[model samples]
Target: MARIIGVDIPNDKRLEISLTYIFGVGRKTALDVCRDLNLDPGMKARDLNEIQVTEIANHLQKNYNVEGELRRTLAQAISRLRDIGCYRGLRHRRSLPVRGQRTRTNARSRKGPKKTVAGKKSVKK
Candidate 1:
């Protein structure tokens, strides 16, 4: 395992994919980091030398807000929205989809398990 930005990336994965183990870094950012640092994106993390790992760690510290920093800022933004009572904030508070997806059909992920409400017995014909 290679520890980068406090996250232990999988040793067998390519450097670019392994870099994505750090918070706030996606595939695009990982590729960009490799390009900027002149590191080989195709190399496996297990093959990284100590100096290369340290260089990557130092580079991330200097250039990016990741892990705890990113989480804190995002939490603060959500709290601000909640405090201001915005529609999106309310949606977040309610645990529903926040992107205006129609709740009438599919939002099972955010809406949770279906609650079975008993209906009135059918009237006699």
Candidate 2:
């Protein structure tokens, strides 16, 4: 395992794939990092030398907010939205889907399990 930005990336995966283990980094960003650093994207993480690893860590620290930093940044953004009392913020505060999702049904993942209510029984004539 290669520890980058306090996260242990899998050693068996390719460099680009392993780099995505860090939060805020996806395939495109990983490829960009490899390109910028002149590293082989297909190389396994375990094959990296100490100097290469250090270089990678330094580059990420200087150029990107990843791991805990990215999480904190996103949390702050959501908190700001909540403080503003906007519609999206209200949805986030209520733990509902913020993006105009149909809450009438199929939003159980965000709205949580169904809270069924008793329906009125039919009265016989």
Candidate 3:
């Protein structure tokens, strides 16, 4: 369990993939970070030296607004849109798809399970 930038990277994974365990870092960013730090992408996280770990932490802290900061910034942006009553905001408020996906027939993942409506029974006179 190697802790970098306040996040514990999985020791089993390669350094490149393990770094992505930290929030706001993806595959591409992880590769870029390794390249910038002059680290071998295939190296395991547990094999990182103290200086290399420190360099990674410093680079992440200085160059990227990650973890809590990223979450807060995203939340604030969404809140601002909602407060302004924009169409996208309204979609978010209603818990509907915001990217113009057809909701009438699809979007089951977001809409959840459908409820059965009661119907009148036909009487045989």
Against the true structure, whose lDDT is highest?
2
Instruction: Give lDDT per model, in order.
Output: 0.91, 0.92, 0.90
Candidate 3: tens digits of C-alpha lDDT, residues 5-121: 789999989999999999999999899999998899999999998989999988988999888889899999888879999999998788788899999898888777886789999
Q: Which window of 10 residues has the lowest lDDT sum in candidate 1?
A: 57-66
The better-scoring model by TM-score among 2 and 3 is 2
Best by TM-score: 2
Per-model clash counts, in order, read: 0, 0, 0
In candidate 2, what are the lDDT values of residues 32-70, reduced to their tens digit?
A: 989999999999999999888989898888899988888
Compared with the true structure, what per-residue lDDT tens digits does model 1 show for residues 89-118? 999899999998999889998999998899
Clash pairs of candidate 2?
A: none
Best-to-worst ranking by lDDT: 2, 1, 3
Q: Cα lDDT for residue 90, model 1?
A: 97
Off by over 4 Å in 2: none
Alpha carbon deviation, residue 31, candidate 3 (Å): 0.9
TM-score of 1: 0.92
